[model samples]
Target chain A: MTGYTAKKAGYAIEYIALIAVVLIVWCVMAGRGTLNEIIMPAPSKVLDTVTELIGSGVLWTNLVISVVRVLKGYFIAVVLGVSLGILIGLSKHAERLSVLIIQIIKPIPPIAWIPLVILWFGIGESGKVFLIFLGSFFNILINVHDGIKQADEKYIEVSKSMETPFFKHIFRLIIPGAAPNIFTGLRIGLSSGWMCVVAAELVSSTTGLGYMIMNARQFGQTDVVIVGMLTIGIIGKLMDSLLRAVEKRAIKWNWSE
Target chain B: MEHKYIEIKGLSKIFTRKKESVHALENIDFSVDRGELVCILGPSGCGKSTLLRAICGLDTEHSGDVFIDGRKVIKPEKTRGMVFQEHRLFPWLTVEENVAFALNGVDKDTKAELVQQHIDLVGLTGFEKSYPRQLSGGMAQRAGIARALVNDPELLLLDEPFGALDTFTKMAMQKELKQIRKKSNTTMIMVTHDIDEAVFLADRIIVMSPRPGSIVKVIDVDLAEPRDRNSYEFLEIRKEVFNEF
Candidate 1:
């Protein structure tokens, strides 16, 4: 137990060391006037801006909006992606019919769809949600499809020998077999969704961290911009950590090594 | 005429890969009596595994008929159970869950009771909640056995089930398998490369040769219970089997 705790402490130190060094360098550079305050603000100034935003309730409001958008889009992507993935994965006919279209659309970046999305849905919540969905959907679909396709033939045989019912076979063998890959998809899809929401906000929005960063930049409030960027980073990490925690519990068998 | 419990007539498997066709098994004929432990012993690449798969109805492309208990084998059924060389236990499930994998339609209490009985049968009672990865190779294979037996299969097909274990563990598993067979009275067909394993476990050994696998010999083991490996009759039988190779 002590050894485990020590190892955890070691990791914590490693994580903090780089951030501390970067912060010290930023403080020194800004204090010495070696860096332009307009372009790169001191760590202390960014911290002060964070305090100001939090005090005014601006941070919480925008954070909630961005989080809601991400959740909405991510939920849709997961439901559709997993269902479609299983469909395609199980049926060769479905795979053959959809493969070419999926391949053609997959390579195109979500940012490339911004103009088309704006034209279709305008600069409203729908447009942003649509953009986020596009960004996350393909990642999830491909991963889930791959997961199902890679379901162990041996396990399938076991289920077959048992004469497992159709739905039981799918739920017990195929889905669980594809779980690790599905989790991978969810993680990547989530990160991509987060990125899409920020990009959409940046392109056309009056709220969200991306808008805050852009607005702050126009006024040369580099501290607020930095604060916005930091908020995005911190929130992204937190969300990923939350996912990882759930993953650890869901697939504890995978973590034996 | 007394019908055999399991019969394989003129079984042949040809694999058509790309442009070339390879003969895997050729005109394999065999019959296993009810509650008999039969082992198909052969060298590697002799299609013994393929033969087991055919009997298990996992391979339907073979050109022949396998009748089990007067019914024609079409596809896999709950009455037929198979254990592969690898434990092949689902890594996501605990030992208890793995054992209970095939008991889907049973009520919760019955399922749990059956799972508990099989776990105890396999000497894995204490480690029911442990995942496959957490168990040793032998333990995992025991769980695989438990899983196969959970459905009360009338026929159990094992393809090199203990071929991956160390010699000592293999011997111990062989003994455990004998006890299991005695208790269940289920007809068993095991494929193995180990001659001693066949000699120890099989009521009759069907030895095969590679390059389009075909049965070369049918040797009945008339030895009594707890057959000793070092005994004179055992060595004589072992030598006879080895000489056939």
Candidate 2:
């Protein structure tokens, strides 16, 4: 469970220096009273706001809502994307037909769908999730397609020599071979999912970390905005680390072998 | 009047890459009797591996016929199991799982029993749960052999099975292969560039030369079983096979 436990002195120095620089800038600005309070709240004030939100159970509720929204969208995107991606990757006809459509739709930013999503689903949880799904689905699809397409021809020949059927070859050989790429797709999908959640909440939601930040901005509660932003960054980092741990166990052979 | 277990007549292969054509094999012909162990000996790029692929039905883009028993080989069948130069054991699967890979439709009890038996045959009984990455080069090749044998194939095709191993390990593996062949008595055809290996294991060695590879000689090893490297007969056969180079 202890991952990357060997700490290098150079890396440690870099991390400490980064934090020290941020702290010095914050302290100098607060002490000199150069920036207005509404624009750049004191770090201490932001920390105090975080504790207050935690004590009142507000932060927990927003965090859960945002997490639930992201999970819903991400799960749906993975299931549909992986299935269709495999289909399109294996079949020449499917690739020919879908490549143009996928290319046209994939490059459009997830936030650009906000107007349509809101118009179709209203400002409910479904609309927010739809936006997030749009954010993640295409990236996951493309990665999975590439993964299946790029499976080692040698392994495929192994399956062929075994008289393995097409479906069996795909499930037994291709999917597993494509796993490393699929994991990469999942990680990218997650960050994109998070981005969509915040963007969607910014425009229409009333009860997420993004909504909290936007709502606090209206009330000139700059400390609360900083707290919300910091919470998002911390959560994203934690999720990525957790994913890295799982990936290490799953693809350990890739490293040592 | 005599039955040939495997028959190849006028087999030829030409590959095209980037609008350039290269002849891999030309007008090759050979046959092996049932239960015989044969080795195709050649230098690198001499079409020995290509011949094995054609026999195993992995490459059909050739001009000729390969008959296993009385039937023309068309597509790959479970009857012909193959092991590549590298221990192509799937990284995701454990040793046991890799051996059981071909027994997809078998009953669970039968599958486990067969897997265990083959694992034991390859001297990997204790490492069944280990992944291919955890194994040594020889151990992984043993696992590959076990995987190929788990299906009880009529013919086991090996493409330079010990080419990647260190000298000592390769010698040890060659000895174990003899024992395995004696125990199972399954027909096998191995491709190799090593003349010593060809003399050590083959009942008959088909010597080939490169550049549109064609057979130059077919040397039958008449040495006794448990072949000794220092024996006069062994040296004579080795010298004879090397002379074809």
Q: Of the candidates shown, which would achieve the greatest TM-score relative to the real structure?
A: 1
Docking class of 2: medium
Interface RMSD of each: 0.9, 1.5
Residue pairs with colliding backbones in model 1 are: none
Where does model 1 exceed 4 Å of error? A1-9, B17-20
Candidate 2 lDDT, B1-245, residue by residue in tens? 55589999899999898999888999999999889999999999999999999999888889999988878888889888899999888888889988888776889999999999999999997998998889999999999999888888989999999999999999999999899888888999999999999999999999999988899899889989889998999999999988887
Q: Candidate 1 residues B64-108, lDDT tens each?
A: 899887788989888888998999999988999888888978999
Q: Write the per-residue lDDT of candidate 2 for residues A101-166, one digit (tens) a residue.
A: 999999998778888888899888888888888898998999999999998988777777777767
Worst 10 residues of 2 chain B by lDDT: B97-106
DockQ of each: 0.84, 0.58
Two-chain complex of model 1, DockQ on C-alpha atoms against the true structure: 0.84
